[model samples]
Target: MPTHTDQVPETPRRRPPLGPEHRWVILGVGVAAQASFSAMFSGIPVTAITMRADYGLSTGELGLVLGCTALGVAASDIVWGLLTDRFGDRRILLTGLISTGALLVLMSLAVVPTGDGRPPMPLLAAGLLLAGVLGGSVNGSSGRAVMTWFREGQRGLAMSIRQTAIPVGGAVGVALLPWLAASHGFRPVYAVLAAFCLVTAVATWKWLHEPDDAPQGGGGTAGEPVRERSPLRSREVWRLALASALLSVPQMAVLTFAAIFLHDAEHAGAVAGPLVVLVGQLGGGAARVWSGRYTDRHGNRRGYFRTVGALSGVVIACAAGLTLAGAPVLLTASALAAGGVLANAWHGVAYTEIATMAGARRAGAALGLEGTTLFTVGFVVPLAIPVLLEQSSWSVVWAVAALAPLLGVPLAPGRRP
Candidate 1:
């Protein structure tokens, strides 16, 4: 269950998370809050042109700078998860969002290059890493909020909606931040990203609250009839977490390489590459919501994940084969789009299943563990892709990537009731 603070006297405790009466409002707040952070996490990469220019970073250095955020996220998720368990989701959300915004403001004032002098590469990289560490709170906190506030039938839908906020915020960031960076400067880009966090923080403060049934002092199992399953020790939890991480590998493969591969192979980076990205992100967002709602009614999240994993493997393998055979670019793009959507489609479903297995009380740690594993892979995939490409052909690299999702299919446990 979600909780706001310890020793709540009267005032803040009255507000809801806000229970069934205003749960949708809580969801809206969650989406907006998540989107704000997602924009920074996903959008910053798109500002590479201006960032590289201002910082005078080499291509390799730029990769490290970018990788730093993912590293921080991987490093801190479990810590945040543990904190979320001790505190509550709202407290963590408010603290994390506000601190994130504050750090960005600091970056605008101190870190970004000004008047022809550049900040140290280490400083810039460290700032991004710290931002990731602060912002990473959203994953477990927001998810735990859903697990507490919503019951099973709607939890899948709710979780997926929350999940889509990442891409929605990201798409907005990608669309806007690059232009802002080019036109105004990094100060304004930092300011705008900070604005997203601050604005969402306000929403979170006003709307996010403890559910009516939450434990008074804290959330985890204080008043329960039985002690909840601790996800940290559960074999099922580890298996599902591992499965989720494995499937994400193929999604990362498509996300990181589709554009570069298309550019090199078909010189279609101008149109087809972006088209594939747009298709994957947008379509993946829709597919996630749709699948979540579908499975909510069907009661088969594990089964759903298994099917999607197999299909993701098949579709991506086809895309790789088409590229290798020098087939029509349209067919390859279509295949990539399908593969990306399928690969991403199961995130909410898998997270819901994992959280469900762990129970609401332990949801934070379970989700945190899952995010840590996925992000660790996320950090590794981008770096590994280039190395694998240099050592082997594109066909070999993509063929290897396709196997990841297939390998993940068996890792999900049987459907939970």
Candidate 2:
């Protein structure tokens, strides 16, 4: 994948017609927002070990803990989208960062031992609910802010950069959290992430600003104020959502279980677990940026979606075979690296399509539905994987996983409905 600088057009160097200076402020704040949300998602890999020990949970239950966050994220995404349209982007973004950070700190505290050795389910559930509601808004709100700042052509690059925050933040957690858990325990991990979130929130509150005027071609009138479009009413919106949901099945399954498969199925080590997670996420992050540029060049994002989906199925099948055959560690790692690259590369392309089809006014709502559907499927599928593994084999699980992305084939060729 080309770096951000390499992807620029060779037409000519030019200045903006908007009569403004560089938008460095917007970019800086955008990175912070992405980082905060990244922290939220990234905490998963770090917390997995602590969660297993504290809750006395199995591998599937551990997957459920993270998956449950998706349920909240999916539910809140639409609500936040409606709120962003109604109240404006600044308010929504700030609320999301600050509130989500607070809830994360609370989640850390809730899981702390309370005199006795027993875990606190009610407190944790309440905290998780709050975290979900606020943390989930990070998805819709950040995109809304980006749409406000960037032009149509600029959006693919901008959102791809923003998407990098997910894995980058997760990578940070993966790199840090395990070591943190190994040495200091989970409370320190929570404290560190919460601190990062609060700092980003403060930065966002001080620096972030929405454009006073709306742009052209974004589902708004030239003179009239911007209005949020209803995603539920749009057929194209749901088709995009369906495609994304199916795409997520493999993506989520792989990420959720890759570490366990490496540790349990492959007998690698504590070291290999996070190494695979980091490698996959890093590859995924790069793929997102590259695919975004590719889609913009091609003009048919649905086509890119199907192609990546099909190829990802093949890559994952090879990884599954290696796992079944007990292939060498290097071979398994190679398959994982290749598969991870293909698996998550389509995210930005799919999202760019949503933002374009829905337009700015409706982009938040459309993405809200899209994220909800995708993560809702993500949350459910992994929870079932343990059951599937118990009854059948990983081969069956992989075969079923391979089939989910095929659902996109029909959607890709059809018209935007």
lDDT of each: 0.81, 0.71
Candidate 2 colliding pairs: none
- lDDT of model 1 at position 111: 89
189: Cα error in model 2, Å: 1.5
Error of 2 at 360 (Å): 0.8
Clashes of each: 0, 0
Poorest lDDT segment (10 consecutive residues) of candidate 1: 220-229
Which pairs clash inside model 1? none
Model 2 lDDT per residue over 168-247, tens place = 77778778877887777667777787888789888877766655455543423134345455767878778778877876
**Candidate 1 regions off by >4 Å?**
1-19, 48-54, 113-115, 182-185, 220-226, 269-274
